[model samples]
Target: MGAPRILVVDDNKDMAQGVAMVLREAPAEVESAYTADEACARLGERAFDLVVTDVRMPGQDGMQLLDVIVERWPRSKVVMLTAYGTVQSAVEAMKRGACDYVTKPFNNEELLLVVKRALRERQLEEDLQRLQAEFEGRYVFEGLVGRDAQMLGVFDAVRKVAPSHATVLVCGEHGTGKELVARAIHRLSGRKGPFVAFSAAALPDTLIDAELFGARKGAFTGADHDRKGHFVEANDGTLFIDEVGSMPPLVQVKLLRVLQEREVLPVGSSTPTKTDARVVAATNTDLLRATREGRFRDDLYYRLSVVRVALPPLRDRIEDVPLLAEHFLSRRCSERGIAKKRLSHRATRVLLLHEWPGNVRELMNVIDRAVLFCQDDVVEPKHISFDEEATAADLSEPQSYEATKREVLERFQRLFVERLLHECDGNITEAARRAGLTRAAVHRMLKRLGIAAPHPEARRG
Candidate 1:
């Protein structure tokens, strides 16, 4: 909560003092060291939030100092001060883990801006780590595991809204754990009745109504006896409706009435039964667009979205991959009653590098599969397998610096574009807006990389 503690290192005492003075304006606890050895001693004595060092220090220069900091205090961020001609060296420092760099005779505003950004990022990372440490058990909030800023926000929202009877709408891509969140809310709702779930997309149009709102004997072609619908069965409890965007027009009308009147009229029955079931609807598609296209009712959409919760995709929160992967691996091993399996360093690196298009669900599946396939206790690169697409790079072999850089950049571009399209649901304009790129530029890049959008509509635009 207080100003960040900073350490300024330079062999020249005057230069170190001058830089320290400028940083002190931010009201930080600034300390100076005249040599790398002195700086290392100070770091050992106590932790500093940020370390600013001149690139050309006598006896163990900035690069060496960076290495020591990275190995000894990985959490602390570093900023390099470079002479004009050594900009490349500063960039090298960044590649090695420095947060940022500024040239000598720096502008105070620019320096402060970089420092603020680095500090903010570090704070977010630390907060996420704390959350993860606290929620290491499988159930952070009813069998959900996440430590990213976005997921933490989702957890907070669920906690704040669980006690209320407000209709909730959970929105995310497929396999992003919308149902899990719904379950968490229900568990926290203090409702004694059973939790019931129905998927709108999995049922036939003719059966949708009958299944949702009970059917009396002989109501339809094969109705043998009276049946209780989700609304009636979940009375005094919670009802989760999955893939609500796919509900039929008639069903939408009936559901809207249920949300409004809190009652259901079973098929072949004139009498309506009062129900106190709390409704939670989930969708992977955009209900607003569905309404615009006349596929869904606008009033129903608004009624369901009283408290909307949007879950982040895996790509957006790559930082949580390691934690989730380890949890899955350990759980699977325990279920099998086998010795614990662990990922090799190489395997961990590969897992971190790949883009998880299928989200947390896909990552879990991969970990389980890897554990099963590995002959030894250690899950190596060979044991791991991804989807049919050859998106993962072959890290078994070494490559030139240029080749590795090019490959990494291309993969990142492809993944970023794919996620953008998915988030926008094939709407090119929306994707462009979110990506801050013109439509033509994205199209050109996609074409050049031979990357196709998952939604065909994006390709057309």
Candidate 2:
């Protein structure tokens, strides 16, 4: 937290002193080392925030020192200084763990700029690590991983309402972990019976009644033998009903009756059966809106939503992407019996910038695929791919049709522009020309869409 400590290492005493003096402009604690061995000695004594080392040093070269620092210190950033002819070597050093590199004839401003950028990036990584450590076990509930305010609120609500006998309604977009939340609630509910799950969307209207309420031996066609329904099977336990909004009108009325009477009237049965099932329903549709539109019953909606749990979409909680990605990566690697792999800085940026239309499910799949395809110990940007065809799910809460249309159009525009820029090798002028648009218009669009313009070096690459 004090002024950052920096070490300048070069075989030439004059050159080392000169680099150290230039870094004084940063108001940093700067020291000079005439050899890589001397630099190692200094590093062993105390940690330095950044180390600027020449690529070709006498006896022990800068590359050897880089390997040592990477293996031993790990956190301290190293920047390579190379002559014009050895720029390729500097780049190789970067791949081996150097934060950045500067050419020998670089201006003081250029060197200082690179150093400051590296320092800022190091700080950001440290902050993210601290946050991950702090929230790893605390914010995680069951299999869910998040530290976002909205997710934290969901966790808190689940804990408080799990012990009660209320009928809970979980509302979220598809793949936002609604089922995971239901399981967590069930685990915490301390029920004596096993948890039973049923999806109304996965069944036909004719079979939904038989599935929810038990049937007699000759109840209807295909009712060859007596069978217990979800309510009966989940007796004295939690019954997780997914896609509850898809239930037919008659089934909804029957469900409402079961909730009120604490029993189920089986098909072709003379007497009602008593049951004590705790209902936990989930839907990706806006049931309240459905009620107003007369597509769903208002009384049923109210009864099901006794304790509502709303989950925010992935895009709304982008900061948790890194944590979730790491979780998925670790699990995938362990499952495959492979050594752990890590994401490169560029790969991490790729993950962070994505919109994650499929939420956690999509992220997990991406990580699994990356782990399976990555050849090295690190996952690079080239190994990361997004599903271009997966459009965002419909909003769980109701919104004006025009607003929804605008949102969808913006998402499409952003994806189109990104692909264009990528195909043109990140050259704004080339992308604009190819797209039949002005370069200025493209720049404006990038700014409006909160997209970072590609760096000149990246464009060349």
Candidate 3:
């Protein structure tokens, strides 16, 4: 690899040269520019491996320069330097497509590390793009983040199925990012058709049939016109059915026949539709158990599991929380103007320690909420708002059977009330109604658990 040429842009010549000196000390070539104009000028002359720019500058500020650099010289990596309390500008720089940002007076080691990593990422992206262009749509996949053994097994399965015609069966708990895996398969497959998706759990049994098998005009009312079902629409492409375990028995039978017969029989239509679609089915329920219990068809399970892929839950790959959090934070901060922020190591540790029952989806929501309301650039532990009850339940570990039983029951009751109240918007009467209890009873449980109605909307009847 050649030397990493870094362009340090600052209004002050001294500050710019100082940044350049830091980079020169490292195993990289360094250049200094006193203004954004000079930086762009250098970019036009020769492509530096990376660009380090100041946030506040005289004319044509660093952010504007960042936009130009990313647009015209996207291959050049950028690092933004901003003073304390000016994280908003740094975030804007990232949003405009800077690789990363550094706070003013950053530790020398931290700044060097961020630059090296960002350049490495850019190099990898460029390499991937080059290979993809040469190979004609072969994708290695992204989004499924984990280094756990279980997840590696899943990744291997994806690799085998991506280039083949095999349908994939992804089984995992809810919010484990099953769809992300399905999309990865589709991307790698390069089937050249639309990737159609639907959730079996989101639709009622009656509509599930029509949605998957299409419906002719006036097919039992509300079928005003001929419509293409997901299977037909996804022909030559991948059809992702989420919560496939929730699919009604009748629909499952029809879906199975489609898989076996390579065709679909639309509702209220005598003719069959050719099923040239790649099917990717995912479910949270234990399909094997369901099969033995006669709730799920064994034959269907066999077909789907021809390529079974299991995703690791968030708790399983807790080591990846910081990476995931930082990814979310960067995109979110850039989009929402929440100011650039990184999680304090302690806060990051707390996040990793919690058992993420809701998995990746839940983690993203929590991080987004924290970033949304964060008052400072660094996300501290306090901003990481989590359910005390949930954390307590996950933390209160193994003990004697009797004590465990007691704690389990207590946690359940607490979570149950909390969920009901949350669902009813903290309205005690509505929560009581949902729980089949009296308002007084709900109030007592809330009092015992120290749960307070934080919002007035939640208190409405």
On lDDT, the leading prediction is 2
TM agreement with the true structure for every prediction: 0.60, 0.58, 0.61
lDDT tens digits, residue span 1-461, model 2: 78889999999888999999999888789999889889999999999989999988779998999999999989999999888536577668878999998887889999899999888888888898899777776867878889888899999999999999999999999989999999999999999988999999967776899888988988888999987898999999999999999999999999999999999998889789999999999999999999999999999999999999999888777667777888899889998999999977556666665778889899998898899799899997678878874324432444543454456457767878999987988999999999889989999999999999999997666
True-structure RMSD for candidate 3: 15.1
The segments of candidate 2 whose C-alpha lies over 4 angstroms from its true place after superposition are 1-134, 389-461
Evaluate model 1: give its TM-score.
0.60
Candidates ranked by TM-score: 3, 1, 2
lDDT scores in order: 0.86, 0.87, 0.80
Identify the superior model by TM-score, candidate 2 or candidate 3: 3
Q: Candidate 3 residues 153-235, lDDT tens each? A: 77778878988988789988888889999998998898988899999986877689999989898887788898889999999
Which pairs of residues have clashing backbones in candidate 1? none
Ranking by lDDT: 2, 1, 3
Q: Which stretches of candidate 3 lie over 4 Å from their true place?
A: 1-43, 48-141, 387-390, 393-461
lDDT of 3: 0.80
Which scores higher on TM-score, 1 or 3?
Answer: 3
User: Candidate 1 overall Cα lDDT vs. reference?
Assistant: 0.86
